[model samples]
Structures are given as structure tokens and as C-alpha cells.
Target chain A: MIAKELKRGIITENSIFVLALGLCPTLAVSTSVKNGLGMGLATTFVLICSNIIISIVKNWIPGKVRIPCYIVIIATFVSILHLLIKVYTPTLDSQLGIFIPLIAVNCIILGRAEAFAAKNNPATSLVDGAVMGLGFTAALLILSTIREFLGGNKIFDLMVIPGFQPMAVFILAPGGFFVIACVMGLINYFRGKKGAKAKV
Target chain B: MTDTIKLILALTLISLIAGFAIGKANYRTKDRIAAKQQAARQGAIDAVFPEGFKIKEMNDDGGILPQKYWIAFSDDKLSGYAFEMAGSGYAGDIRFMVGVGLDGKILGLTVLEHHETPGLGSRVNEVASTKYIWFPFGGDDKTKPWFTEQFEGISTLRPIGVEKSAGEWHRLSEQARAGLRDRNAVSAITGSTITTAAFTRAIERSVSKYLEELGGYCCPATRKKREAEAGAAAGENGEETEGGDDS
Candidate 1:
């Protein structure tokens, strides 16, 4: 059951690439691989922590005010994460800047809390959160790799090609959209080809 | 209803716990955070005045930005002045420290914080492998460290200009270097014109306030002449007239 959830979240239903949730931070911080990884892990931690807490208290939460309760729970984890990052990792703290606080509103955590955690047991909800968080992190990694390699002519600040002229646009806002579009397009194109072969 | 009451109670309880947790975290990190901030400030000061100097905070002087001003002494003699200044940059506010020799020439400058675009204006504080500011046409050699180093030895007599008219990153000629020393021209960063201009304006404004505060100081002939030039410039600028009026 846990394995199925992991596969489902990571591949069958990716939050960013497939379901297309939480695209704002996806575009904003994917300018570099380091930022993408930082944001991805931060969001992941919030997701896992919120899901566990929400599942434990799911029975106690009133149905009419469940949404508010979930938000409060998610926000608590986000605030904790924010303070931890600010104190222990100030470099990543300043780099992510506004996005750190904005994690409270990231749809992935709330989406899972309402969709899966509300009805699942604590153990199941924990697995679901971990898998979903990994999915988000993987998607961000792919997008950031493409953007950073082309835009910065480096991967994790290491220059790949000595004299490659980096396309500056790839690291900016518009470039994020372009990279996301192309990656999703390529995925769909292969999927369509696979579907055609099945028909044959 | 009883259900509504329970809901409110639950929400309040969660809020209380969250607040307490955050408060605890804040308490634990407060001292470390302050120490880190002080270390960063010390690093900026060290970078600006690589030549040894002792700096002390001056309480009575209020500059244009209401920031703390520090007096630097080298070898038991007044060496320069260091103060904080902030201005609107291309993306957001740019805060930096300026180190000026007693003769009004810039000893060094260090950017404290800025939110400019990366790979462009954000390169203001980028450190280079070496200290020398290379001449133009140095390929990608003219980087962040080079830009700030250009201000060194340039006095604050005149407003600096971006290299817009020249359209070339040529080396400063002997005459041009003299102009730089005389505070006539300080070349701006080639690609980051707006950020460069903002920085220049911040320096000019802060230097003006610094000169005003130093007006009563008994200094040498050169310091007196520089003071007169700064005083005249200060008189014309009415926007920041508070410094002069109060004194």
C-alpha cells in the first residue's frame, strides 16, 4: 500500500508536472538548482509534518471548520520550518526570501491534507505525504536542472562547458514557463506514442 | 450550539500552542542570530578598510538615513569615516557601508544587502579572486569586485556617471584616473547601469551628510578645502535639509 502511494505520487500523478499544483514557487525559485532543492525539501518537510498532525487530529476536527484547522496545522509546520531555516541556514534563508513564508499557502500540503489525510490513518497519511513531497521535489529538480544548465551554463554552480554562452532568458520568469511547457510537452508526446503502440 | 463552541475552542487551542512554539523557537535563536548579524557587519567593515583601523560608533551624529555612523582611527590618528546608507536600487533597497579617508577620497565601499536581479544588478557584492579592478575589454574579468573597487581613491566631490556616453569599457587614462581622484568621474558598471547609478547616488548623498557632520572638525588644509566644496553642495540640496537645520 505504501509502495503504491509512493509510485502514484512520484510518477502516476506528479503534483507539479501532472496535476500541476503549486506552480508559483516552481517558476520563481527554479532559477537555480540550489534554490529548487532548498524549496523542494522545505515544502516536503512541511507536507510530511502537516499530514501526520492533521491525520492524528482528523477525528477531532469539526467537518464545518476542517479547512481552517488544516490551514492552522499546516501554517504551524511552515512557521517552524521558516524559523529553523532562518537560524541554521541563513544562506538558503535569504536566497528563498519571500517564498519561505509563502510555503504556508502551498497547495500541495493542503491538497493532501484534505484529499488523503482527512480520511486516512496516521501511518497511511505519513506515507502519502512523504511520497507526494518527493514527487514535488523530483519535478522541481528536473525543471531547475534544465533552467540552470541552459540559463546559468552551470549545474549546481559548476560550469559544464567552459565557453558555453548561457541563454540568460532561461533563468528568468518567462524561461520558467518555457521549460515547464517543453518538459510536459515531451512527456505527453511520448505518452501519446505509447498509447498509439498499444492500439496497434 | 455546542458544536460551534467546540470549533472555536479547538481553533483557539491550536493558535495558543502555535504561538507558544514559535516563541520558544525565537528565544532559542535570538542570541545566535544577533551574533551572526554582528559578524556580518564586522566583515563588511573589514572589507571596506583592509588597512587596519579601529572603529567606534558615534551616537550624537544623525545622518540622512538615521543610520549609525562609525569613526575610524588608524595608528592613534583619525583615518576615515564609515557610515550606513541605503537607496532605491533597480529591484529593491540597497544598503551598504562607505569608508572614506580623511581627505574625502573613498577608501573602500561594501554592500550590506540588496535584492537586485541575479547575474545582473545583483553582482554588486560579488567577490573576485583578486583585489585589483582591471581595465575595460578585460573580457568577463570586469566583475563585481572590480565595480566597487573603482570607487576607491575616487573622492566625493562630484556625482558619479554611468559609462553611457562612452559605450566602451576602456581603461581610465592618466587624466581619467586623476579625475577619479579629484571626484570628477567614477565609471559605472557596464551592464548594470541602473544599479550603478543608484549606488553612486547613495554614496553622494551619504558623503554629503558625512561632510556636514565633519564641518566643525579641526582638520588640515586639504580637509578644509574639501569641506568647503561639500558645504556648497550641501547648501543647494534642500531635500535633506534636516541635517543642516538641526546643527
Candidate 2:
């Protein structure tokens, strides 16, 4: 059961590629693999913690106030994560500056809380959060790898191909959109092909 | 009405729990964050000045910004000054530390903080490394950012120019660097002229004024001239005004 959920989270219900949640941060911090990873982990941390907390308190939380309650929980996690990052990894803290605080508003955490965590048990909610978080991180790594290599002519701040001229536009806002579109299209095409073969 | 009250209570309880958690986290990490910031500031100050130079905080009574400049001493004698200046960048403010020698030439510069565009403008703080991931240990380690390294030896007495024609400092040849030095210019980061210009403009606008103010405090000629002027003013007023020039 856990393995099936993991597969679903990572592929079918992937946050960035399939569900298309939390694209704001995806576009903003996906400039480098390091940054993308940092952001993904941070978001993942928030998602897991918030999911568990919301699920545990779901019985007590009134339906009318559930959204606000979830936000409060997610925001608390984000704030604590922000402080921890500032103290432990100041470099990543600076690189991912405003986006850290903005993670409080990321739909992935709240979406999980409302969709799965609110109705599910704490144990399953924890698993769901972890899987979804991994999905988000995987998508970010894919997008950032393409952007970082094509835009900067380097990977993880190291030179890959000597004397290779990089396309500067790939590092800009438009490049983010182009990469996301192409990746989404490719994923959809493959998924469509697989569905056709299964039917056959 | 009871249902409404229960809803309010649920949200209130959750918020209270959140508040408590965040408060605890802040209380725990506050000191570490402060220490990290202090260490970074101290590191920047050290990077801009020569090794083993003692730093003394100067009085900024008549300066534009208080606690912005510090006096660096070598062998108990005044060697130069280290300054912290902030300028408006493309996205937000860019704060940096710069060390200038007695001869008015920049010893070094290090960007302390900035909020420019990540890939473009943020290159101000980027340290260009030759370390290839494949080879890993093959290339030389470069600690200081190549962008700020070019500012070394540029005089602060004149307007600092930003030139894009020469390309980035890291890619430039020796001859091109010499040409830039001759022109009292630094190569601008590609596609980040605003950030580069803002930095140079801040230095040009404030460093000269700061030096002039420092001259009044240290330079014998300027001290004598200021004293004479003060004495003349005192005579006109028929009163003694000493140590009153600094406000």
C-alpha cells in the first residue's frame, strides 16, 4: 500500500508536473540544483509536519475554520524552518531569501492538508506528505538541472564543458516557462503512450 | 451561535499552538542567527583589509551615515579606512564593505548582502571557480569573488566608471585589465549594469566625502586650515568655540 502511494505521489499525482501546485517557488528558485534542492527540502519539511499536525487535530478542527487552522500550522513550520536555515546554512538562507517566507503560502502543503490529511489518519497522512514532498523535489531537480546547464554552462557551480557559450535567456523568467512547458508536454506524451499500450 | 463559537475556538487553539512553536524556535535560533551575521560582517571587513590590521570604529558625528566607516591601523599607525555602504540595486539594496588605502586607492571590496536578480545581478557576490565537477581537484581554488577583485587598485578620488565593452573581469586578459585600470573603471557584469552602476555610484558619492571628513580629523594641513577658519569665526563672534566643530 505504501509503495503504491509512493509511486502515485512521485509520478501520477506529482505536484509540479501533474497537479501543477507550487509553481511560483518552482520558477523562482529552480535556477540552480542546490537552490532547487534547498527549496524542495524546506517545502517538504513543512508539508510533512503540517500534514501530521493537521491530521491529528482533524477531529477537533471545525470544518468552517479548517483552512485557517491548516495555514497557521504550515506557517509555524515554515517560520521555524526559516530560523533553522538562517542559523545552520546561512548561504542557502540568503540564496533562497524571500522564497523561504513565501513557502508558507505554497499550495502543496495546504493542498495536502485539505485533500488527504484532513480525512486520513495521521500515519497515512505522514506517508502522503513524504511522498508528495519527494515528488516536488524530483520535479524541481529535473527543471533546475535543465535550466542550470543550458543557462549557466555549468552544473552545481562547476564548469562542465569547457569553452561552451551559455544561453543567458535560459536563466531568465521566460526560460523558466519554456522549460516547464516542454517538460510537462513530454511527461504527458509519455504517459499517453503508456496508457495506449496498456489498453492494447 | 455555539457552532460559530466552536469554530473560533478551533482556529484560536491552532494559532496559539503555532505561535508557541514559532516563539520557541525564534528564541532558540536568535543568538545563532545574530552570531552568523556578525561573523559574515567581520569576514567581509577582514577580506577588504590586509592581514593583521587592527580596526577602530571612528566617530561619525559629521558623516553622512553613522557607524559606516572604520579606521584600520598597522603597527599602531593609521594605514587606511574600511567602510560599509549601501546602494539601490535592481531589486533592492546592495550592502558591501570596501577598504581604501591612505593613497586613496581601493585595497579590496566584498559584497555583504544584496537582493538583485538571482542569475544576473546577483553575480556581484558570485565567486567564479575553475573547479570542474568531472576533474574535481584539477583547478585552482578561488575564494574571493572575481567581480569585486577587479576593484582593487582603483582610486576612490575620481568617479569610478563601469565599462561593459571589456566583458567580465574573470574572462579578461592582462592587457584588457590594464586598460580598465587606466580608465579608473571596472568591468560590469553582463546584463547587470544597474547593479554594477549602483555600486560604483555609491562609492563615488560617499567615499570621497568620507575621505574629506577623515582628512579634517587626521591630515595636518586640513586640521590647520579648519582651526584657522574656526579661530576667525570665534574672533568675529568675540567668543571661544573649541571642539564645537564636530556635532
Candidate 3:
């Protein structure tokens, strides 16, 4: 059961490519591999903690006010994570900046709470959170690697080619959109092909 | 209704727990965060000055100068002054330190904090390098950011010019840099002119005025005259005067 859920979260219901959630932070911080990893881990930490807390308190929370209650839990975790990052990893804290706090509103965390965690057992919810967070991190790594290499002719701040003139646009807003669209399109293509073969 | 009460209770309980957790987290991390910030500030100050320089914090005296500034002394002689300056950039606030020599020329500039668009405006603090990772032989890594490096040796007395057409400072040759220095200008970062302009404008707006006032304060003749005046005024009033020896 855990393996099925893990496979489902990491591939079938992957947050970025499949669900198209949390694009704001993904685009903003995916300029470099380091920033993407930092943001991903920060978001992952928030996701895991919030998922566990919401699952534990799912019984007491009223259906009518569940959203706000979930938000409060998620925000608390994000704030704590923010403070810890600020103290322990000041460089990552500065790099991630507002996106760290903005993780509270990342639909992935709230969406998981409302959709999966609210109804699931704590262990299952924890698994779901971890898988989903890993999925998001995977998507970010792929996107950032492409963007960083194409935009700066470097990977993780290390130069890739000797004196390769990078296309500066790949580091800009338009480039972010272009990269996301292509990646999403590629994922959809493979998924569509697999669905067709299964039906056949 | 009991249903409404339950809703409120649930939210209130969760919020209370969250608040407690956040407060506890803040309490735990506040000291470490402050220490980190202090260390960064000290590092920025040290970067702007040479080795073995002593920093002395000067009282603002509640004068027109709004920011707190420090005077740097080397071997009992005034070396330069360092102060924090802030201005709005393309995305958000950009705060940095500026060190100016006694001659009003900028010694160095370092960005302390900024919230700018990553990969673009943030390049203001980036040290540009052409060194390849595998080869890593030909080009050298830059210690200071090219954007801030260009500001060194530019006089704060004159209005600093941002030449957009001249290209980025790192991309320019030696002759081009010399030409820019002669004209009291620095090349703006491509596609981030606002960030570059904001930093230079901040230096131009604050440093020159503060240096003038600081010069007057450090002048021995003016110091003697001001002391004599303060003494006479204190004798008459029998009380300490404002803006006198408060440092």
C-alpha cells in the first residue's frame, strides 16, 4: 500500500508536472540547482510536518473550517522552518527569501491536507507527503538543470562549456514559462502514450 | 449554536498551538539569527577597509544625517568611514555598506542585504567569472562583485553616473574602465539598470553629505572653536549643551 501510494505520488500525481501546482516558487527559484534544491527541501519540510499535524488533528477540525485550520497548521510549520533556516543556513535563507514563507500558500501542501491527509491514516499521510515532496523536488531539479545550463552555460555555478555564450532569456521570466511549458508538455505526451497503450 | 462553537474552538485551538510553536521557534533562533546578522555586518565592514583598521561608532548627534556611520582609524590616523545605505531597487529594498576615504573617494562597496530578482538584479552582488570547472586554468574567480568593484576609486563628491550603453563592468576592457573612471561613471548591469542605478544613487545621495559633516567634525581648528563656544554656553547656562561631546 505504501509503495503504491509512493509510486502514485512521485509519478502519477506528481505535484508540478501532473497537478501543475506550486509554479510560482518553482519558476522563481529554479534559476540555479542550489536554489531549486534549497526551495524544494524547505517546501518538503513544510509538507511533511504539516501533513503529519493535519492528519493528527483531522478528527477535531470541523469540516466547515477545515481549510483555515489546515492553513494555520501549515503556516506554523513554515514559520518554524523559516526561522531554523535563517539561523542554520543563512545563505539559503537569503536565497529562498519570501518563497520560504510563501510555502504556506503552496497549493501542494494545502491540497494534500484537504485531499489525502484529511481522510488517510497518519502513516499513510506521512508516506504521501514524502513522495509528493520528492516528486516536487525531482521536477525542480530537472527544470533548474536545463535552465541553468542553457541560460548561464553552467551547472550548479560551475561552468559547463569553455566560453559558451549563454542565452540570457532562459534566466528571465519568459524563459521560466517556456521551460515549464516544455516539461509539462513532454510529461503529458508520455502519459498520453501510456494511457493509449493500456487501453489497447 | 453548538456547531458554530465547535468550529470556533477547533480553529482557536489549532491557532493557539501554532502560535505557541512559532513563538518557541522564534525564541530559540532569535539569538543565533542576531549573531549571524552581526557577523555579516562585521564582515562587510571589514571588506570595505584594509587590515588592522579600528572601527569607532560615531554618534549621529541627531543632526540631518539619518543613518549611523562608523569611522575607521589605522595607526591613529583617520583611514576612512563606513556606513549603511539603503534604497528601493527593481524588486524590493537593497541595503549595502559604503566605505569612503578621507578624500571622498569610495574605498569599497558591499551589499549587506537585498531582495532582488534572482539571476538579474541579484547580479549586483554576483562575482562574475569565466573560469571553466573542468579546465579552471585560464580565468580566475573574482573575490568582489564586478558591480561593486567598479565603484571603488569613484569620488562621492561628484554625482555618480550610470552609463547604460557602456555595457557591464565585468565585460569591459581595461581602457574602457579607465574611460569610465575619468568620466566618474560606472557601467550599468545589462537588463538591471534600476538595481545598478539605485545603488549608485544611494551612494551619491548619502555619502557626500555625511563626509562633509564628518570632515567638519574631524577638523582640529573647527573642533577647538566648537569646544570654546560650547564651554562659554555651558558656563552661562550651567548645563550640558546639546550636540556637544555626546560621542
Candidate 4:
């Protein structure tokens, strides 16, 4: 159980893909390797930090307003990230564009604040954030790598196909829709197999 | 009453633990995070120039530009300078960096920033289509060509100054200059004339500003070399340097 917390707890493949959290940036900035990485890393930071905060104050939050309280904490962290990125990492701030602030609605952060950290030990929650965030980042990288490869040619400019004429649609908004749909299908297929294995 | 007190105690202990953990994590990673960000910003500056050049000056206009930068070369072979360049592009302000070399070459030109609409007007940085379109073309239409190769080989140093001349236009290449001096010379981007002219005029005015402010921009080398060999017939005749003024 402890080991699982570190591997797939915070940012799980299911939450980000199967359940579909943080779709805004996932679709908007997945056009290239650089944008994907920037959005992934930034979102991870916000997720980890917000999870820890919500866990700390979980008991103090009024039962009637726990949801609103969690949102405020998450929004606060997102705002700080926005300012710091604007001052220090102008390029990425521009690349990620408006999606950065959409972190407020990024269900992954909010969902974890409500589900895992709000009830678990701070240590376990921390581990959960790291692992889950990694899972999300990994999923993003996989999806973007495929989309960029087919849509733009070259994985992060590494040139995987030995020079394929980009499929073109893979880089546009429609391409994002298709890539996410395919990834969601893969996740569902594997998850169903696991469910069957468990039944056995 | 006793239960409430117990709840408060439990909450206090959890807060203490959470605080300690967060503080430590940030302490461990703060240095690395701050350092990485610093390096990235510095890297943006270094991307424009080659090594061995030291920044001899620094200034900023402070209105969105935030900085005006000038760096001189140790060998005196090149002096590249950059100023915040902006204009009312189709969508909004098109922000970019324009760096110029001492030999009148554009050391490098990168659109450092922008806010233009994505699919239609953001092709400014899409170098592949930049030659022809002033704006972006959605997926299937991207590789479809529309630009004439006439503008090929033209760079900032060749025909146009950062500033436009009255009835003047940017010459794409030295070979192409003879045809560009006419007031009516040069056609606009097929579809987005406003954007093309905006970008052209923006770049032309910018290059011209640095040229004029730099005290004497040698017309591009190919032309300069020719003007030198001919001794500028007007100079040999002791007549006024007519075209040299960029009139």
C-alpha cells in the first residue's frame, strides 16, 4: 500500500486520462514537445503544492464550505505560479498562454484535494502528489509524443520516423481531440483487462 | 465540549506536520527551481549572439519592452543591438526581438513574443510559410505554396532599413534591389495585406531606427563593395552624395 502511494497515487493514469482531468491544457498546448513539457511540469508543481495545503487544513475547513475552501487554496497557488512564470519564464508563460490559469478548474488538483489528501496522512498525500503528477506528466508526454510525431514529425525534435511528412491534422485542435480519444481508448482497454484479472 | 477540544488538538497536530513537510520540500527544491529559471531567462539573451561578445550597454524603454540591450564585440567585427519591437498586428501587439550585427547583418531575428490569433495570423514565426504568408494557414493548406521566390536571399541588411523611406521598400536581396526602389514596387502578402505591410513596415522601421541611430549603416556588403569600387562616381565627381542618403 505504501509503495502504491509513491508510484500511481497523486496523478494517476486513470484520473488524467480515463477519468479525464486537466483537459484544457492537455488539448491546447499538446501541439509540440516544448509546450507539452512546460504545461506538464507547471501543472505538476501546482498539483503537488495544492494537495499539501488542502491536507494541512482539511480539518479546519468548514464542512459546509470545504469545496470552496479547497478551490481558494488551489487558485492561490495557481496565481503565484502565473506571476513567477511571467517574470522568470516569459517564454513558457507565453507558450502555455491562457491555459496556465485554467489550473483553477483543473479537476486533478481539486479532486485530489477532496479525495486523497483531505483524508490521508500528510506523508502519504505528498507521495501521492508526486506519483500521480508523474503519471499525468507521463500520460501527457505519451499522447503529445504520438501527436507531435504524426502531426508535426519528430518527437521533441528527435526525428523518430526518419523523416515522415507530418500528418498535419495531428498538430491542430482537432488532432488534439483525436489523440485524446485514442489514448482514452487505450486506457479503457487496459483497465478492463485488469478488472477481468481481478475477477479471476 | 470535550469532543470539540479533542478535534482542535487533532487539527493542530496535523497542521504542524503538514507545515514541516512543505517547508522542507520547498527548501530542498527552491535553489534548483530558482537556478533553473534564472538560467532559462539568461539563455534567452544568449540565443541571439555568438560568444566573445560582451554587453557594453543596457537600457530599456520600460513600456512593455522592459529593456533596451546593446552589446559590442571585442574584436570590433560586429556590434549587435536589440530593442523591443512591437506593432498593432491583426490580433494585437506583435512583440519580437530584432538583433543587428555590425556588418549590417541581422545577427538573428526571432519573434521573442506574440499574442496574435493562432491559426490565421501566427505564421509570423512559421519560417517555412513565413516567406509567402503574412498569416497562418490551417493544416492541409500549410505546404500549399503561394509566395514568389523573388523575396528569397533578402535579409534586413540588403535592401530595406529598419525605417522605411518615402516611397521606398525593402529589397529582399542585393540582386533584387534595382527593382524595389520604385514607389510602387513590391506586392503585399496574397491574403493578409494589412498584416504583411504591418510586419514589413514594423521590421523596416525597426531596422531603419537602429541604422539611423547607429550613426552610419553601411549599405549591404554586396552593394557597399560595388559602391566602393566605383568610388561612388558622384564622390569622384565631387558632387553631392545623392542616393547614399537613402532618399
Candidate 5:
């Protein structure tokens, strides 16, 4: 059952692909696979930690001000994470830059906190956060891989196609939308085929 | 009424706890963060000069606000000076470090912080050359970035200006590559002339200001004379002092 729920987040309710929760950071950082992966892992860390804490203190939080309470908790965790990253992993800190602070306002985190963590047990909420975060990361990775590979003729900064002329447009802002649409179209096509076969 | 009071108390308690936790984390990581920042600045300074150069921060005797610079030493002698260069760019301030050699030539330049558009203005930070499989259609062929690399070996004594028109380099024939290596020319980023011009102007201003203020100390002969004068003054009454050491 828990396994099924986890799969649902990764597939059926994938934040970027299926639900389209956080698109701003998705588009901005998806210029490179490395940046996408870094952002994904950072968001995942914050999500799991915040989900567990919120679950533990769900009852203590007042209903009238729960939203503000979540913000405070998320902001606190983000600050701690930011400080830790800056101190221990200065390279990643500089690469991620402002996005680390932006993670606090990411809706996927607060959405999950309100919908799942607040209502569920600590263990369930933890799993949900992890699964949702992994799903988000996976989407970003897919999008960035395509964008970086085609746009820069490189994968994770490695020269893949030795003599390919990189299409500079693909790594730009509009390229993000084009790639996402194409990927989404492919995913939907496969799903539609499966649905037709099931009907038969 | 009772519920309202309870809610207020709960919110206050949560905020207090959250604040305390963040405070603790900040206190724990404050020193490490500061150290890392210092290391980053040192790394930038190191990149501005060639190998085997030590950077010593100079005191703000002239009281230049927000612009702190350092002097470089190699082989137990002064080599060049690096300054924290900044300018109002397209979006926000573009900050960089520039190494001006003893002969008034730029040794190197490195962008430290910037808030330009990601794909366009942000190209200022790009170090690697864009490669093409076939003919190099792009005029920029050097492994180093054309924007800053052009400044290398170019004397700051001349006025620097960005290539304002397109195909300016393409129009120049192979024979003119050397003779047309304008001492006062910098290649601007395509589609981001504002940012390119901003950085070029900043470099020009900084170099001229440095020349006017400390031109005497930059040359070997003048530096030796200044040192001898300081030594003689010290022997007489210990009154003369150069810029104080920052590091």
C-alpha cells in the first residue's frame, strides 16, 4: 500500500509533469542537468525534514494560523539548510545561490504539508515527502538532460557530441517550455495507448 | 475568547522555538561561513594573477567606499595589484577582480558576483569557449572568454571601448588581426551590449583611478625609491609608513 502510494507521486501525480506545481524554479534552473539535480536534492532535503517536523507538531499548531506556522517551520529549516550548505559545501552553495532561499516558498512543500503531513502519521508523511521530492527531482532531471544535451552539446558539462553545433536556443528560457511540452506529450501518448488496450 | 487566547499562545510558542533553532544553527555555522567567504575571496584574488603570486590586502587610506583592493607579490617583489571592480550592470551590480600588472597591462580578470540575465548578460561569467563541430562559425574561438581575455596583455594606459557594431571582428581580415589588436578595444557580448559596456567602463574607471592614485608605487624604480625613502625616514625618527597590511 505504501509502495503504491509512493509510486503514485512519482508517476500519476508527478509534481512538474502531471500536476505542474513548481514551474518557476523548474524552468530557471533546468538550463543544466547539474543545476537541476542540485536543486532537486536540496528541495528534497528540506521537504523530508519539514514534513516530519510538521507531522510531529500538527496537533500543537492552531487552525487559524496554521499556514503562517508552516511558513515559519519551512523557513527555519531552509535557513538551517542554507547555512549548513554554505559552510560545508561551498561549491554547491555558490552554484545554487538564490534558489536555496527560494525553496522556502515552493508550493509543493507547503501543499504536501497541508494535504498529507498534517493529516497523516509521521512515518507516512515522511515517505510521502520523500516520494514527492524524488518525483520532482526525476522530472527536473529528465527536462534538464534533454535541454543541456541538445542545447549545449554536453551532459553534466562533459562534451558528448564532439562536433555538434549546440543550439543555444534550447538552453534559453523558451527551450524549457518546448522540452516540457514534448516530454509531456510523449508521456500522455503512452498512457493513452495503455488505456485503449485496457478498454479492449 | 478562550480559543483566541489559546491560538495566540500556540503561535507565539512555535515562533519562539523556530527562532531559537535558527539562532543555534546560525551561531554554529557563523565562523565556518565567514572562513569560506574569505577563502572564496582569496581564490578570486589568486585567479587574477599568474602562478606564484601572493596577495596582500591594502588598507583603505583614501576611504574608497565599498572598493577594497590588494597588492600582489612574486619572488619577494611586487608584481601587480588586484582590485574589487564593480559597476551598475543591466540588472544589478556586476562585481569582478582585475589584476593590473606593473607595466599597466591587465594580467587577468575574473567575475566574482553578478545578477544579470541568465543566458545573455550572465555570459560574462562563462570561461569555456563554445565549440562547433564543423567550421568555427562563431568568431569567438579562444578557450578563454573573449570579453575578459581581450583585456589580458592590453595596456590600461589607453582608453578601452567595447565593439559597438556587429561583424566588427568578421570585417577585419586575417592580416589585420595583429595590427588591429586595438589596445583600447574589448569584445562585447552579443545581445547584451548594456552589460558589456557597463563592465568595460568599470574596468576603465578602476584602472585610471588606480593609475592616478598609486602610479608611483606600481613601477619597480619608483617602488625602490619609495622603500629607500621609508627606510631613511624610519632610521631618522620612525615616522614614514606606507599602506597598512590588511591580511
Candidate 6:
């Protein structure tokens, strides 16, 4: 039972890469390690908090108003986080930009609210949120690190090799789409092979 | 009359309850939100000037504070000022924090915020690339090492250097500690000359404002002649006031 949750959160599974969710910020702000971390942490806070609250109120909310309720709860948390980050970490605040508020529509957060939290106890829902958030953050960090290093030839601002011809395109919008394609492609390829072997 | 009265009374009662609840919630959170904003502002000030600063005063026009602040040093030793600098680029607004030293030299600068068109204007953020002001003129900042070097120890008299773009002039003047303000020239960023010039103008204006408005009467030798020119201009305008008031 414990292992299942761990597996679901860690490998054999991923929220962003494998599941193909929250691709907007995954490609947009994941251009740097710092951006990835900031977005990841903020998402985790909103997801966990939203999941817990949505679970508690799931029974009380009319089906018609459920989506709106979840959205309000999520948006409120996101705005608080946005203002908090702005006053505190202005650089990170600016770096994440509009994506910070777009967490309202991140789909992953809302998807979990409907699929997992609405049906489960608040306890499992909270864990599921945290795990999913973590999974998403980890994937973002990996993709961003790859892009920054290959695209800019500097990992976290420390120049490793003196004369590296940075793949100029890797840091732009197209580079972002390309990186997503590659990451998703890899996940599908490996996951597919594993599933095939399991069936055999 | 009886049905109409009953409906009106019911509606009024519901509205009253709704208003009271909303008002009470807003009133409670109003203070909390204000406190949070103050804390956030304090945090930004601390991060920028960890040495600590004084509010000194506050001014605003209306809803959007074009420049939300006017912070000064507590010790009075630090001249110049720190504030949000902004301007229109080829894309959206480019915003940044500019720090000017007492000498009219750029103490430090950091892009606080911006939303330039990606690839074209976004290159401005790539430090060390020389594609933008990412180069540090002569500082420890790896990305912008020494590009701002041109900005250091510059003349506050003429905000725009004469012949060439401003950056080149700053670069040239750095070699010599000439008291004469160089209106010579600085190399402007190609293709994005307008963008580069706009940023330079913002920095120059902010620094000059600090010097003229609040730099006190201690005009450096570089500004000596410009001082005379300014006095002459004031005389021409016939707005010359008596004595000095360092408010």
C-alpha cells in the first residue's frame, strides 16, 4: 500500500511528463533552475491546500457550483502566493510572471480536485496533491536544467567549459516546445516498453 | 399594497444580510492586506539596500503608482535615490530598479520586471551575452560584468552623451578621471538602439533627479560648469529663487 503511493508519485508514473498535464508552465518558465523551483514550490502549496479544502467541502458543494468553488479556492491561494512572492522574492516573482496566476487553470490542480479529492478522504487527497505537485516540480527541474545547460551553455550560471557553442534555439519558445516533445517522447518510449514487457 | 410591501421588505432584509457579511469580511481583511503589503515593501527595500533605509516621504498620483516609492538613506551619507524605473520598449513596459551613487555613477542596477517580446527584446535579460545590458561594466555580477562599467563615474550634467550613443562615452571616460563632463558619445545597442537609448534615458533621468532634487548643494566638479549653465537657464526663465532649501 505504501509502495503503491510512492510509485504512483515517483516513477512508473508522473503528473506532467507521463500524464501529459500542466505543459504550459512546464515549457514557459522552466527555462532556468530557479524558475522551475519557484513555480514548483508555489504549485505544491496551492495544490495541497486546494486538495484538502476541496475534499472537506466536496459534500456541501452543489454539483453545479463545484467547479466554481474549487476555482475560487485555488485562485485565492494563488493570489496570496503571488502577492507574498512579489513583496518577498521580487525576482522570482517577476520570473514566474503570469504563470503564477495561471495556476488557476493548470488543469492538474483542477483535475485532481475533481478526480481524487472529491471522492476520497481529505488525508489521502492531501498526500496525492503533494505527490503530484512534487512529481510535476521534479519534471520541470529536469527539463529546465537540460534546456539551460544545452541552450545557454551554463548550468546555474557556472560556466563549465570555456568555449561551448550554445544551441541558441534551446532557450527560445521553439526550444521549449522541442524539449517538451523530447521529454514526453522519452517517457512514452520507456513506459511503453515496460508495459510491453509486463504484458509478456 | 400588502404583497408589494412584503416583497420589498424581504428583498431589503436579504440585501442587508449580504452587505453586512461582505463588509465585515472586507474590513477585517483590509488591515491584514495592508499589513502584508507593508511587509512586502519593507522586504523589497531590505533586499535592495540591506544597509537599511528610511521612507522619508511618500507621493502618488492615483490608482497606479507610476513610481511607487521615494526611499532615502537614514544616515544622509548616501545620496542619489532608488526607485522603480520604467519605459515603453518595442514590446511592453520594461521595468527595473536603478541605484545611483552620490557621484552620479550607477551604484547598481537590476531588471525588476519586464515583458519584452521574447527572442528580440528578451535577449536583454541574457547577461554576458552582450545581446543586451546583461554585461556588468566592472562588477562582480558575472552576467553583466563591466557593461555598466561605462555608467560608472559618468557626468550627470548632460544625460545624453553628444555624438555617439551614451554607453561608448561612459566606456571612454572611465579611462580618465576627468572633471569635465564628457558629452562625447557612447555606443548604442544596434537593431535595438531605441530600446537601449530608452533604458539609458531612464537611468540618466532618475540619477539627475536624485542629484538636482535631493543630491544637496554638493555638486561635484564635473557638474560645476553645468551648474552655472543651469543657473543661467533659471535666470533666463526668471524663476531664480533666493537661498537654498534642502527639504
Model 3 misplaced stretches (Cα beyond 4 Å): A1-6, B135-139, B216-247
Can you write out model 6's per-residue Cα lDDT over B1-247, one digit (the tens) per residue?
A: 7666655554455445445644665555566556764565454344434355654433322111222344566576645455556656655566655555556655555554566433224445555532222332433444452333344445544565523333332234545424223542334432345555556776555546545644453334434456566763222211211011111
Best model per lDDT: 2
lDDT agreement of model 5 with the native: 0.75
TM-score of each: 0.79, 0.90, 0.90, 0.57, 0.82, 0.63
Worst 10 contiguous positions by lDDT, candidate 2 chain A: A164-173
A64-170: candidate 1 lDDT, tens digit per residue: 88898889888888887877886788767656767888899998889999999999999988888899999999999999989988975666655566557778688
lDDT of 3 by residue, B129-150 (tens): 7777687766777778889999
Per-model DockQ = 0.29, 0.67, 0.65, 0.08, 0.29, 0.09
Q: Can you write out model 6's per-residue Cα lDDT over A1-200, one digit (the tens) per residue?
A: 76787679756668787777888777777777777878888999989988998899787665655676677777767766766675567656545666787888898899899989999999999999988888888888888888877776656544434556667577767888899889889878988999999999
Question: For each candidate, how many residue pairs have backbone atoms clashing (under 3 Å)?
Answer: 0, 0, 0, 15, 1, 15
lDDT of 4 by residue, A64-152 (tens): 55676677677767776776676667756655666787877888888888888899877777877777777677777887888867875
Model 4 RMSD in Å is 12.7
Q: What DockQ score does model 1 reach against the true complex?
A: 0.29
**TM-score (2 decimals) of chain A in model 1:** 0.95
Residue A182 lDDT (model 5): 95
Q: Model 4, range B76-106, lDDT digits (tens) per residue? A: 6446664445656665565554455655545
Please provide, for model 5 over A3-107, each residue's C-alpha lDDT reduced to its tens digit, 9 standing for 90 to 100: 897788789889898888888888878877778898899899989999999999999888898999999999999999999998888756545667778899999
Cα lDDT, model 4, residue B119: 25
Evaluate residue B244 in candidate 5 and report its C-alpha lDDT on the 0 to 100 scale: 15
In terms of docking quality, model 2 is: medium
